[model samples]
Target: MPARRKDPAIPAGLKIMAPEPAVRLAKEAEIGGLGLDWSEQPEMLDDVGLAEWERLAGVFAHDATRFREGERAAITAYCSWWSAFATAAADVRDRGPVVEGRSDMDRGRLVKNPATVAMREASQQLRYWARELGLTTDARVRIGLADQGDDKNDDDNPFA
Candidate 1:
């Protein structure tokens, strides 16, 4: 089997590396901006996508240092996926997940709705983008953006 894909190296800015080591590593793995304008929304995005972009942008603004201009495309992709997911989910909600099949053989049978499939695909893509952008709780913890605290709680047992 092929070797497993390696996780992307954490940017020097995200870690607590020493100044000397950080500077040395910078020469080999320097992270730079792409000069993209963040103020304007991408022309390709529709109204739903624009709203998603705005929502994500607002969340990212709180930790602007974590994200850079190089990640604009990733952010755009996340927004696009979110829009697609929202649209597909709405369709699936309006029309149930099971629908009458259009194929000749399955015409009378209730098959899965195309919108449900689209929603599933979009949801998967959204999850991937969320993890990539450190938008998920698990991603944030893994990327050192969140504190790793003990799991101790007053009601540890769910059935309690």
Candidate 2:
């Protein structure tokens, strides 16, 4: 039996989703600009597609805002890029269960693979962009995760 081939179109990062508002607003913006009904666009952003969408959303937000448009635009762009990259990484991580289930399957079983490697690469690229935006030497290094490590910072959590 031949090993089952994974679908090329179904990359590990495909499951990644952007922020909620991003998904809604970006699609609205895109469709409105195109003068097309939102539901009519079957190709309208799924979660993964929203990653790219948010980047443009950030651009729009920055441009429309009254403050330091240039600085805000750059900052928002960097954040959007990071979020997209992170979501992509998370998608790869989500594949773990599928891949594990294939362990005892026959050679012909289609194995779900992770795009962690690819996600990491994209993250690296985003990291560089973040650094450039922040004017930091180690944008990728010494990074922080979403979860706050200590209780003192627990207030930052929305649920708190």
Candidate 3:
């Protein structure tokens, strides 16, 4: 098991939650900005999709206030993107990349299938969601996941 990190000591009258509960709450709560809780439960996703969602969720897990308020829409959007990305990626894997179809003018020649296009669009959205959710390298570094070149104690740096 990965080492369990202690929750940061909070001032009196404050509460904090671990990642898993924060994720569950974000998904299940009926938040106004998310528009009727379109987000799926973590149990609904396949392993890969679930992992991605959890990773994104963990970004805000430490900050209960952010997860509770501002991130609701973002979390739901990420879930929506995950569904699209997973479906498109799976279809491309199971079926060949090219989609076969008929042209508008004549039914004889098929216009290229839109599966590739859909996949590309979903991929782009997934990338955007990852960045927004702090899954990107720059985001991770800012959140203390990825190490910046300066390994020295940050307190020692006067600017910090």
Candidate 4:
């Protein structure tokens, strides 16, 4: 059997439990940023992508430094996937999951709508990009961006 792929190493800045030695090593190994501006939207993006980009930018505004130029491509991909998913989802909603087949043999029969496939593919891609960009709640927690809920005092509460 093939070996499982290892998880990507978390950046020192995003690691909540790194030892001092590991943190120092990670800092030394970190590459310098290209200093690209995050505010500028890529011209290739359509209106839907642009809106998603803006929404994500606003979401990360408080910790903008965490996303350097190295992450721009990931952010762009996430936005693009979001746009695709949204469009596909809308199409599926309007057309329903099944539609008349356009192929020769299946012409008169009902088949799964193309939009349903698109939506599934887009959602999968979106999930991948979301994890890469730390956009999901679980991703945020994994990267030490979200509160881990460890601060609650279980000893003091009867619910514990």
Candidate whose TM-score is highest: 4
lDDT of candidates 1 onward, in order: 0.78, 0.50, 0.63, 0.78
Model 1: how large is the Cα RMSD against the reference? 10.9
Candidates 1 and 3, the one with greater TM-score: 1
Of candidate 4, the 10-residue stretch with the lowest lDDT total is 27-36
Model 4 residue 7 CA deviation in Å: 39
Relative to the true structure, candidate 4 has a C-alpha RMSD (angstroms) of: 10.4
Cα lDDT tens digits, model 4, 74-146, are 8888888888888989988888899999989889999999998888999999999888777788998898874
Assess candidate 4 and give its lDDT.
Answer: 0.78
Considering lDDT, which of the candidate structures 3 and 4 is the better prediction for this target? 4
Model 1: weakest 10-residue lDDT segment is 27-36
TM-scores of all models?
Answer: 0.68, 0.32, 0.49, 0.70
Give lDDT: candidate 2, residue 153. 64
Candidate 1, pairs of clashing residues:
none
User: After TM-score superposition, what is the CA distance of residue 133 in candidate 3 from its true location, in Å?
Assistant: 1.8
User: After TM-score superposition, what is the CA distance of residue 122 in candidate 3 from its true location, in Å?
Assistant: 1.4
Q: Which stretches of model 1 miss by more than 4 angstroms?
A: 1-30, 34-37, 147-160
Model 2 CA deviation exceeding 4 Å by range: 1-68, 97-114, 135-160
- What is the C-alpha lDDT profile of model 2 across 1-160, one tens digit per residue? 9999879888766676766976765675554332222122223345554554454455444334212223443444455555566676676676652344445554655455555555666677676765654334353234532222333765678987
1 versus 4: better TM-score goes to: 4
**Residues 1-160 of candidate 3: C-alpha lDDT, one tens digit per residue:** 9998665675666766657965766665656233222234445556655666666556555544444444655666677777777777788778666555556664665455566688788889878876776767877776666444757778877888
Q: By how many angstroms RMSD does model 2 differ from the true structure?
A: 23.8
